[model samples]
Target: MVESLASPWRHDFPQLLENPQLHYLDSAATALKPSAVVEASRRVLSEDYGPIHRGLYPAAERATDAYEAARSTLHRFLGGREDDCLVFTRSATESLNLLAEGWLQSVLVPGDEVWVTTLEHHANYLPWKRVCERVGATLRVVPLNTDQTIDATQFDDLHPRVKLVAITAVSNVLGVALPVSEIAARAHAVGALVVVDAAQAIGHQRIDLATWGCDAVVASAHKMSGPTGIGVLLARRSVLECTEPLLVGGGMVDLATAEQPVWAALPSKLEAGSPNLVGAVAMAAAADYLSDAGIDRVESHVAALTHSASEALAQLRGVSVLALDAPERDHGIVSFNLDGVHPHDVGQIAGELGVAVRAGHHCCQPLMQALGVDATVRASFALYNDDTDVDALVSAVENVIDVFGVR
Candidate 1:
């Protein structure tokens, strides 16, 4: 087991410093904001702020520059092409909803199918399902392997009725990183649009849009140590031109008339109403912070912590880890169930001990149904975590076992 006893970058998070006893392992839900990210938000909201794409004053110009510059930074971060369309939204949830309402609703017809995996968070699944329901299209679920990992071969290229395949780069519950690029290739062979939900993979992995060959992608900033209430939708220019915008008003219109409205081009058309200026700056700062820390180093460090946690949990007689037997799949998360103990109870007890883990279905009720369980305890890692955090989590789980008297 490759383990790091200490994290070099842990000092960057002020919350950890403020409460040294707090072991926050729920990074899969939302990461703890680093000082750099917090400072970025503080500076944007308190100072150095201005209106974007409106007003002729100096402050407005600077605001527009900062907002667009943040977009450009994220575009470069995703290794986007010149032809890619990057639009900001409220959250990854809104981005997915936009695709479902703006794009899929136009193309889906009776007997056509939209595909999603059982591992999806409700945000990815429900929007498509609702859109498909309205359009008389079917929502087909791609099943998981017996080990609960996604199989790349299950994409099923021969299925011609499938118009889109929406999959996640990482399973939030299992922590198994799927071969989305491989899946994208197979889906592309059949001329299917591929949309990846990168909300979980945003901070954990480096994403290359060109290499993934997906038509579009969505991610949330809060999940990656950025401020909440802002996310991004990135798509091909084709998707940008063809799909209609979900929200309409102020900034997105080129010309409005009595009969019809002429929409603005690319990103401005997609982003309607007032933008979250502070969120954009903070997210970009988070991207820079992660880049400086080295994504590969972050990946390795988290893998080691996950491996240690998974192995330790497995050794306990009553604990059942909901992960693949393959240790290589360990990617900053370890979710499990303790025998005969409710996950809520486990979570509550863990929190009391200052080991904060997520509990319940994790917004993946379908996945829970597949696993024959109602809920689970999810402990996820980040760059700020170390071996000590893993030990605290294990110790808390042991305390749960003692309290519940589970064999």
Candidate 2:
């Protein structure tokens, strides 16, 4: 058994302690919430429930204050400027769609090109694809290297007609970090705007919009131990000022005449209706918890777990660990396949043994096709996981091989 790199802060999460036998390795899908986040959410739902930005009552005022405060917290957490507009959405998918419909559709024209990578999740890929189709623009792809990371050298293939580049900071399936800063610099040289899908990277790495030099970034709250139904889109102030709102309704309009309606300011104009106030508060608490724990320490801890688990799994016969021969650059995700066993069956068997993992294409069918596999079993680590969880996962896979007789 590998020595325990037990998380000192694991006790902060009540869900992990609630079921001692359960080994949750599916954090890439959604993280288990910490007690602070849960308590914060409960407090909001129980005491401060009210419609925001519409009333002068104490409860309404408190709700609006808390909601906007949450935005401020996230902005600082992400290293965003105070003037930047952070729009709240249901998920990263909605954030990308908003940019597609609100920003890209207005700017793109026939014969223009957009570049995306093979490592993108469907949320990042499909939006650009649809936008390009609608505007008669061409969607180009940056192929992946043999190790499954983005081939940065191929970025020169970006034609002068390329108007935008949409890419992920990390691959959801392979966990390899891409050179977003380099890509952004290259794309900017060609006068193309860069949009980053940071859903998988936000929880594992420190995000600084200024350092990346990208025009926009989108990430989800749930993946970082926050509440569901809340996500953030941080864009440059200039970009938000010019990009139109995807959804227009109450709370987003400043003035509405018979023929013309003036939209509200930066953040509110993008936020179409009553926002997920409770979710925002909980997500803020989550961000505070991560910050207090030190994101660098959390990242280092998870990376160690990933390396240990990947090395162990690679030693097992009939288990093909993806990117095992390549230099280690994964965050915390380790995807693999058991010979002759389908990924879903592998996941089901692991679940029966109290080991939770994710199976299937992981919302990246294009990536799956590029990998030449229909699906993969992914065991993703988080701040709450330890060596015991890795042992449990390896034991479960051993049981799977025994049951299937895969030599």
Candidate 3:
């Protein structure tokens, strides 16, 4: 049976709604925003713009309410409790850095172990490596199995020396969703902390942070269909208490003294200077938008689209889909390499064909080295994508093979 997979929410994105021919397959890079989120952002910039927390004026109060409301929505979105602290940042990269500096650096001893994976995005990997370098901690990188899952043998003995486990919810290149809950269980069993980079898995999967048992979680707004220049760091109170301020400025101070300075509360101390207030409100609107749509439905929608695309692409001669044997392992992304063509050429040809797919390392050069390929073409799906988008991708890949005469 041919799957008549059409996204019911396709019309939600103004960009896709306007241009039917433009098949956007690069959503894993950054998802398209829904009108609801766009409108909320517009209202923030034009109508409700003001300083938050410090302003006693009407506009300031409204700004403060909207900003805090964004936090409240995200708290619930991440299945956060009252004790959890949510701090806004410029991007997930910054969030990871903040944890590395504020929390990880503060707690890590010279002999501690910070476990990472070869599958991590650079944002997750580099921070830990640099932090380990600074603190004299050992950075242990766990290799991946053939199917892009973590190798079990690497965890033969979960030691207490492992101070932190930094990993991603989904591999950006392979699109594989790891067993975070299980990983966290192992980490916690050894009395270690787990910090997850959920930048790719944010909207595609419903993240119950408590259930996952992560000490801290980081994500970006633009990746989840919100405005850019804003991201978030959600951490447990214990982690926040241990974490010092990454950046301290105007909005984050409790009391400024000529002799000595006093720090603000948990989140404020962490969030210094002027935040992206407009982006925060817009991101909350995005959280609300995804909440209303239901994440389970979105996950299923993307999974189906991904499986179908993976099958179609794998059928092409001289093409190999990464982790094709374990399609279920990945979510919302399908990556592959043509036997004879460069990924750049494939990506360029695909782009010329009106299908937008990412053709590079996907910011996972370490992962590419693990896969033994310099780069792979990545077709990432979103909630608003459907079978037609997959069709365009398949056709574009076929074009690449034909252009290169690799058949």
**Backbone clash count for every predicted candidate, in the order shown:** 0, 0, 0
TM-score of each model, paired residue for residue: 0.97, 0.97, 0.97
Clashing pairs in 3: none
lDDT of 2 by residue, 196-235 (tens): 9989988778888888988889999999999889999998
Model 2 spans > 4 angstroms off: none
lDDT of each: 0.89, 0.89, 0.88
Q: What is the lDDT of candidate 3?
A: 0.88
**Cα displacement (Å) at residue 140, model 3:** 0.7
lDDT of 1 by residue, 1-407 (tens): 22556899899999999999999999999999999999988887777788898879988888888898899988877768889988999999999999999999998889999889998999999999999999899999988787778878888543778899999988888888888888988888877899999998888688778888888889999999998899999899898788899988989998977469999988899999887889999999999999999888888888888888998888887999886484346888899999999999999999999999999999999999999999999999999999989889989999999998988
Shift in Å, residue 215, candidate 2: 1.0
Candidate 3 or 1, higher lDDT: 1
